[model samples]
Structure formats: structure tokens, C-alpha cells
Target: METIGLIAGNGRFPVLFARAARARGLRVVAVAHRGETEPDLEREADSVTWVRVGQVGRVIRALKAGGVSRAVMAGGVNKVRSMFSLRPDWRAMRLLGRAAGRGDDALLRAVSAELESEGIEIVPSTVFLQDIVVERGHLAGPPLSEREAADVRLGCRVLAALGPLDIGQCVVVERGVVLAIEAVEGTDRTIERGGSLGTGRAVVIKAAKTGQDMRFDVPAVGPRTIETMVRSGAGVLAVQAGATIMLEGERLIEMAARQGITVVGCDEHGNVGQS
Candidate 1:
């Protein structure tokens, strides 16, 4: 059986990927990051190796040893934790030094290069799980009301302004006014913060960076996102089509429908104003 390397991070995403890969008869060789990846991954993977957050060399060695020629990154290692936590191994230190002054893209690209140097190809996380990628159209619930659609447009404008800065992927808008922007705190916090400032009917927009690196840091939302919106009183979610992942999409949509939250997938060039 062919073995694929999984660089596991946090959340159910890695678990879902492992299950899908196994169902397809692929042997999963996973490197689960300590304090980041969930422990349940060991039950799903064929072979699991625990490694620290920045142990690049060990990851490469583990994959090579498992005869894995292809790999996929699943889940996210909290960027905030990387700021204070994480002790880098020698290989990670070298890669970080070489990637000085670069952002997330440069860092992941450098890591991808190191893996490729070891003859392991990094594949898109959607490889066997394309169904979870949100499709274009209104998903779950009814279409946005005219007023909510107006907010969607305004939120899109806000996201466009923030995208190039790599500040955040989500924004909250109400009545044509921007209420909150996501920063280092991440999506859920951003929604909660933004929703708190809105009139209990804010529209949330999440999209990829203008020139986002697909290999890592793709914008993602799931069941928890809807729960956050519900908690924050946000009424609608408008994510960019073809650029975001909706985890447990069907269940997420059903929950959103039950909550009466409108979910729309907008095109890259489409303006929220056009709605």
C-alpha cells in the first residue's frame, strides 16, 4: 500500500483526512505535533510519530523512513503559540534563518522545499476531500435578505482592504459599516468581538488573502464557526468561493439552516456591493 505523510496539527481536520485516506486504502504515516494535534489521531493513522512544533528535520526523516513520497498538511498549528512556545530543532532553526523577513508563505514554501529535497511531494489538503470545499451558491438556510446582502457587500470591501496586509481573513459588517476585523486572535474571536459590536444582525465575511499560499493557511470554517456566530448574534456568513474550506460542510449547513443563518459563496471578483 502507498504511504502518505500527514503533518498533523490541531482540530478535527487532520482526523477527517486520516479517515478519508484510510478508507481509500492509503497507509497514513502521521507526524503529530505535541500540544497541537489531538491524541485521537493515533487511532486513525497507520503509524503515528509525535514531534514538537518546529522539528522539521525529524518530520522529513520520519516520512523518508516510512517510504512516503507524498505528504499533506492537515489542520493548523496555532500561530499565537508559535510566538512564545515551540523550541526549534536544528533543521527548523536553519530554515527559519534562511526565511528571515518572510511571512507565512515564505516560511511554508521553505518547509515545502525541504520536504521536496527529500523526494516527498507536498499535495493540496483537498486531495481526497474535495467535497468539503464550499461550492458556489447559497448553502444551507435561505438566501440573505436584501439588507443582509447589503452588509455582505460592505463586508467584502472590508475584507479586500485587509487581505493584502495578511492581517485576517474575516470581517463583520452591519448597515454598510465595518464593525470588526480579524487579526492574530483568529476567526472565532474575531466573530465574537465583531458580533458584540454589531446590532445583533451583522454579516460575516471570510476569504483568503489576495495572493494566498494554498499549501498552508487556507481560510477555513466549520461547525464551530456557526456556533460562534450564533453566540455573537451574527446572522449571515459570506465566504469566498473556491478559497475556503467548510469542515463537516453538510452538518455545518444543516446547523446553520436550523439557526436561520444565511451562508453564501461569493466569487473572487464579485463585490459585496454588487449584491
Candidate 2:
């Protein structure tokens, strides 16, 4: 079987990736972050090594020792918690010292470069699970109302403007008003904050960065996102089609339908695509 390395982080993405890889007859050797990665990952990947955030040296060694020549990064590391608990080894420190910026893309690209230098090629996270990458369409729930569509368009423009700066992938807009832009606090918190200030008509837009590196840091939404939206009073979700992952998509759509939340896939210009 072909062996692939998994650089696992928080959430269900890592486990889902591992499961997909193994199902395709690939051997998955995973390097999971302690406290960040889901415990369930251990049952999906063939083998797993736990490491702290910023332990690039350990990650390299683990993958190398496992005969991993190709790898993919899955899920995300909590930026806020990582700030307080980072344990950078020499390799990570070196990368950090030479980094031009502290943005997510810069840090992730540095890690990818380091791994590539060690002959471990980093592949796109979706290589094994392309089916869940949502295409442009009205995925679930009611069609977007005129006001909601306007909010989505506004959110998309705002997100595109912010993307080049390597900022967050999510923004919340309501009735043409920009409510919240995701920062280190992450998408769920951003949603909660924005939704709280809205009139139950918030539109959540998640998109990839301008010139986003597909090998890592792909935008994702899942069941938790829907649940959060339900609590936050966000009624619509517009994700960049062909550039986002929808984890447990069927379940997510079902939940959205039940909650009367609209889910649509769109382009950078917020033009909803045909299914």
C-alpha cells in the first residue's frame, strides 16, 4: 500500500482524512498535536505520534521514521491556545526566525517548506476526499432572500479584500452591514459575536485566501458550524465553491434544512453557482 503521512490538528478533519486515506488502501502515519487533535484519530490512522505545537523537528523525524515521503496537513491548530503553549524545537524556531510575517499562511508555508526540504512532499488535504469539497449551488434549506444575497455579496467583497493580508477566512454580514471578521478567536466565536449583534439575519461567508496555498490551510465547515449558526441566529452560509471543504456534508445540509438555515456555494464575487 502507498504510505501517506498525516499532520493532524484539531477537529474531525484529520480523522476524516485518515479514514479516507485508509479506505483507499493507503497506509496513514499521523503526527498528531497533543490536546489539539481528536483522540478518535488514533483508530483511523495506521499509527500516530503525539507532539506539541511548534515541534517541527519531531514531526519531521516521526514522518521520516515511518517511511513517509508524502504528507498532507489536515484540520487546524487553535491559534489562541497555541500562542500560550507553543513548544518550538530547533527546526521550528529556525523557521519562525526567518518568517517574514506571523500570519497563518506564512507559518504554514514555512512548515511546508521545511518538510519539503526533508524530501517529504506536502500534498493537498483534499487529495483523498474530493467528494466532500462542495460545489457551487443551493446546498440546503430555503433559497437566499434578496437581503441575504446582498449580505453574502458584501461579505464576499470584504473577505476578498482581507484575504491578501492572510487574515481569517470567515466574515459575518447582515443586511449590508459588516458584523464580524474572524481573527485568532476562530470561526465559531466570530459567528457568535456577529450573530449576537444581528437581527437574526446574519450571513456567514467563508472563503479561501487570495492565491491560497492548497497544500494546507483549506477552509472548512461542518456539523459544528451549523450548530453554532443555529445558536448564533445566522440564517445563511455562503462558502467559496471549489475552494472549501464541507465535512459531514450530508448531515450538515440535513441539519441546516431542519433549522431553516440556507447553505449555498458561491464564487469570489458571491455569485451562487448551479448545482
Candidate 3:
């Protein structure tokens, strides 16, 4: 069986990816972050290694030794926490020192380039999970109200503006009023914070960077996102169609329907799917 490398971060994405790969007869060699990755990863992977947050050289060595020529990054590492928690190894330190800025794209590009230098290609995170990638449509609950659709349009504008700044991919809006924008705190927290501020019937929008690099840090949404939105009293969840990974999408849609949450996958122009 061909062995693929999994550089896992926090969340079920890694676990799901490993399971999917194994189901298709691939052996997975996973290098999980010490505290960020779930412990259940070992059970899904053929082989697993643990590494600290900033152990770049160690990761390279481990993947190389396992004969992993290609790899994908799954899940997320909390950016704000990682800033304070990182213990950079010599290689990571050198890369960071020469990096243009500390933005997510810059740092990931540097890491990907370094990995390529060592003959390890970084593949798109969605490589094995295309079936779950969201398509353009109203996926659950009721179709968004006209007001909600407008809110999604405004949120897309907000995200488009934020993208160039590398600020975030999500925005919360209600009746064209922006509630909260996601920063390092992440999507779920952003939804909660924004939902708390709105009068009612808030909409959450998540989209890809205008020039998103799929090799790392791709958009990931699953059951937890739906649950958070339900608790936050957010009524609509819209993601960038074809660019977002809607993990466990059926369950997400079912849960959202039960909670009266509207879920959609749309393009940047906010064309709601045909009924």
C-alpha cells in the first residue's frame, strides 16, 4: 500500500482523513502535534509519531524515514495559542527569521517550500476528501430569507476585504450590520461573539482567501461549527462553495435542520442556489 504522511493538527479532520485513506488501502504515517492533535489519531493511522509545535526538522526526518514523499496538513493549529506556545527548532527559527511576515499564508508557504526542498511535496488538504467538499446550494433547514441572503452578500464583501489583510475567512452579519470578524480566535468563537451582539437571526459567512493555497490551512467546518451556531442563536451558516470542506456534512445538515439553522454553500457573488 502507498503510504501518505499526515501532519495532523487539532480536530476530527485528521482522524477522518486517516480513516478514509486506510479504507482506500493507503498506509498513513501521521505526525501529530503533542498537545494540539487528538490522541485518537494513533488508532486510525498505520504509524504515528508525536512532535512539538515547531519541530520542523523533526517532522521532515520522521516523514523522510517513513518514505513519505507527499503529505497533507489536516485540521487547524490555533494561531493565537501557537504564537505564544511555539518552541521553534533550529530549522523553524531560521525559516521564521527570513519570513516576510507572520501571516498564515506566508508562514505556511515558507513551511511548504522548506518541505519541498527536502523532497516532500505538500498536497492539497482536500485530496482524499473531495466527496465531502461542499457544493453551491442551500444544503439544510429553510432557504435563507431575503434579509439573510443580503447579510451573506455583505459578509462576503467583508471577507473579501479581510482576505488581502490575512485577517480571516469568516464574518458575522445581521441586516447588513457587521457583528464580529474572525481573527485568531477562530470561527466558532467568532460566531458566538458575533451572535451575542446581534439583535436576532444573525448570519455567519466563511469563504476562501481570494488566492487561497489549498496545500495547508484550508477552511474546515463540521458538527462543532453547527452546534456552536445553534447555541449562539445564529440562524444561517454560509460557506464558500467548492472551496470549503464540510466534514460530516450530512450530520451537520441534519443537526442544523433540527435546530432551525440554515446552511448554504455559495459563491462570492452570493447567488443562492435554485430551489
Candidate 4:
């Protein structure tokens, strides 16, 4: 059987990826980060190896031992924890020391190169799960209103700028005014913060970073995203087409429709339409 290595991090994304890979007859071997990946993944994966947050050497060795020549990174690791709680092994420490400034792209690309040196190819996480990728079109309920559409357009521009800077993937806007930009606190918190700052009716846009390494940290959303929007009184969600991952697609759409929220996917060129 063919085996695919998974560097699993927090959230349901990693679990869902493992399930999808297994359904396609791929044996899933996961190197789950300590305190981040869900414990239930051990039951889902063919084999599970636990490693610290910054243990690059152990991750490589584990994949190599499993005879894995290709791997996908799924989900996100909270950077705050990495800064405050990391206990890197010697190899990881060396990589960190050599890093110029320890930015997300810098560190991940460096790790990818190290894995390549060990004959492991880092493949995009969307490889076998194209169905979950957001297509360019309207999703959920009705199309955005003129005002919401304008906000969507503005949100896209702001998010695009933030992407290249590795700032965050989400921005909330209303009537062409920027409400909040997601930072290390993440999407949900950003929504809540923006919602609190506004008088309701905000548009939230989530997109992948410019030149994002798809092997890791693909933008993801699901039912909870709608709940956040509802609580925050945000009326629209615009995600990047063919880039963002929508977990539990049917249910997510159902929930969004029930809440009367607009969900659209925008292309790389900022073309916003239904999925």
C-alpha cells in the first residue's frame, strides 16, 4: 500500500485530511505535534508519532523510517506557543539558528528544503481532496448586496496585501471600511473583535498568502466559521477560489443559508463569484 506522511497540527483539518487520504487507499502515517493535534488522530491514522513543536529532526526521522518519500502538512500550529513553549531538538535548533528572521515562510521553506535533502517531497495538501477546495462562484445563500459586494471587493484588496506580508489570512470590512485584520489571534478572534467594533453587517474575507506553500497552512473554514459570523453579525464571507478548504461542505452551506449569510469564492485575480 502507498503511504503518505502527515505533519498534523491543530484543528479538524488534519483529522479530515487523514480520513480523506485513508478513504483513497493511502496509508496515513502522522507525526502529530504535541499539545496541538487532537488525541483522536491516533485512532484515525495508520500510525502516529508524537513530537515536540519544533523538533524538525524527529519529524524527518519518523517519516524516513516510515519509508515516506512524500508528505503533506495539514492545519496550523499556534506561533505564540512556538515562541513560548518550544523545546527544539538539536537539529531544529540548528535550523532556527541559521534562519534569517524566523518568519513563517522562511522557517517552513527551510524545513521543506531539509526534508527534500532526505528525499521527501512536500506535496500540496489539496492533492487528493479537490472536492473540498472552494471553487470560484457563490456559495451558500443569496449573492452579496451592493454594499456587501463593495465591502467584499475592499476586503479582498486588504487581505491580498496582508497575505504577502505573512500577517494573516482574514480581514473584516464594512461599507468599504476596514474593521479588523487577523493577526496571531486567528480568524475566530478576529471576527469577534471586528464584530464588537462594528454596528453589524460586516464582510469577512479569508485568503491564502501570496505564494503560500500549499504543503502547509492552507486556509480553512467550516460550520464554526458561520457561527462566528452570526455571533459577530458579519453577513458575508469571501474566500479565495481553489485555495481555501471548506470542511463539512454541505453542512457549512446549510448553516450559512439558514443564517442568511453570503459566501463567495474569489479567484487569485480578485474575481468574486459563487462557488
Model 1, residue 126: distance off in Å is 0.5
Error of 1 at 18 (Å): 0.8
| Tens-place lDDT digits, model 4, residues 194-217 | 877777678888888888878878
Candidate 1: clashing residue pairs, number: 1
lDDT accuracy of residue 124 in candidate 2: 98
Model 3, residue pairs in steric clash:
none
Task: Report, for every candidate in turn, its global Cα lDDT versus the true structure.
Answer: 0.85, 0.92, 0.89, 0.87
Q: For residues 1-275, write the lDDT of model 2, one tens digit per residue.
A: 89999999899999999999999999999999998999999899999999999999999999999999999999899998998889799999999998889988889999999999999999999998889887998899999998888899999899889889988799999988999999889999999999888987689999998988988858999999999998988889999999999999989999999999999999988999562
RMSD, every candidate, angstroms:
2.0, 1.1, 1.3, 1.6
User: 109, model 4: CA deviation in Å?
Assistant: 0.7
Candidate 2 lDDT score at position 218: 82
| Model 4 segments more than 4 A misplaced | none
Q: How far in Å is the alpha carbon of 47 misplaced in model 1?
A: 1.2
User: lDDT score, residue 188, model 1?
Assistant: 88
Consecutive 10-residue window with the lowest summed lDDT within model 4:
266-275
Candidate 3 lDDT tens digits, 1-275: 79899999999999999999998899999999987899999999988999999999999999999999999998889787889999999999999987797888888889888999999999997888889888998899887899999999999988998888777889999988999999899999999999988865799999988787888767978999988887887889999988899988889989999988899988986667754
